[model samples]
Target: MRLCVEVFNGYRPPAHLRRLARPADAAEVVAQGLVGARRIAELRRPRRPGDRRPKHTTPVAVRRVYLCEPRSGAVEVAVALVTGERTWAMALRLELHQDTWCATTLRLI
Candidate 1:
């Protein structure tokens, strides 16, 4: 079976406080890192927080993804905070390709 890995990182707001910039930003971060059909599937999923209904009323900060191809066998992921309203964060997920199926790495970003 192919090896898989998943990694994630983000800021946790104060108790009861929501991070307005997490959802979109997280998506962008993951997008920048991964490629191929598997990467596309990951982007389609609502992996970011606050990405659900009740869209952001105010223009919350936009988030972005940065991918780095390292010499190691694993993938490197990074998040970029483009706006002042947001900060840098990132998460990663690895999937093992097996018999035309994919297995989750059981990682939370």
Candidate 2:
């Protein structure tokens, strides 16, 4: 989960994760980076002229995480994230590849 937050905050895979992926996965990683960056920008946009910019992001706390069948290597998580007075529901799907976990899905609203 920390890894997910780190990528979302920075919008790119760190060096180690980058090295572990196949070509297609790498492309998705880059695309996700763009999406994450854009989403955060929209979320943190200043509402008024004198307001301060948003701060460095903290990882959204996960309410629950569910593991699928043993060989499936898939995990699903539920997280509620607060944006101002609104609490958004977030769901994520991650898969294990070469013994390392990578996010295969991300959704927030």
Candidate 3:
């Protein structure tokens, strides 16, 4: 599948799992090494009435990791939002690993 479609579908292959050098790999290398503070805030915010806010609002970091197969033209990535705590936030990043690198599409689910 094309990188754009795979990312949307969130289908990741097994081999791509090993390439997860670190939680931040995709964020730094692929996602332009940048973190969207507003985006994080939106995700961390309480969506429902029963949802409780964190005791403290801490700044979390974003990282992206990927799995790719050249022959099959498939790529899968995981975007991790790391915080001081062990249980941070994370999103699935899927793409096509091509000769020309581009993060054309993303899904934060």
Candidate 4:
């Protein structure tokens, strides 16, 4: 979950995290999201002194986490800011693989 916040806010993710998604999904996210996160290649400049909001002014935090299947090792996580124009929620899906939990999918809105 921490990795998700960092990735969305312009930080490099760990190698294993890069493989969290299927190849196609990872490719699309990297091409469309991570690249810009690194450099803001398409970010628009502010038109007035206070037109643009500072990046991540509010704190980012993990709101809640749950074990979807407690006895079986399926986990669900939710993270979002306490205050914002809208809820910036991120959901994660993880399953135990070979005795180790591995994230398989991520959704944000």
State which candidate has the highest lDDT.
2
Model 1, range 25-106, lDDT digits (tens) per residue?
4434333433322432343456678676334322213266555544433344454432223343434433223322222122
Q: Arrange candidates by TM-score, highest first: which order? A: 4, 2, 3, 1
Report the number of the highest-TM-score candidate: 4
Q: How many clashes in each structure? A: 9, 0, 6, 0
**Native RMSD of candidate 4 (Å):** 5.0
Q: Write the per-residue lDDT of candidate 4 for residues 1-109, one digit (tens) a residue.
A: 6666565555555343566655545554444335433333123335477797566444344565544554567777665633233345655667777676666666664
Candidate 2's clash total is: 0
- What are the models' TM-scores? 0.26, 0.55, 0.33, 0.56
Candidate 2 clashing pairs, residues 3+ apart or interchain:
none
Better of 3 and 4 by TM-score: 4
Please, what are the lDDT tens digits per residue for candidate 2 over residues 24-102? 5765554554565467556676789898876754443444555554357877766665435435565566678888766
Error of 1 at 19 (Å): 24
- Report lDDT (Cα) of residue 6, candidate 3: 28
Error of 4 at 91 (Å): 1.5
Per-residue alpha-carbon lDDT of candidate 3 for residues 6-70, written as tens digits (9 for 90 to 100): 22223333223324324434444234222233345565678899999888765444544445544
Quote model 2's TM-score.
Answer: 0.55
Which parts of model 3 have CA positions greater than 4 angstroms off?
A: 1-39, 43-57, 62-66, 84-98
Provide the lDDT at 46 for model 2: 75
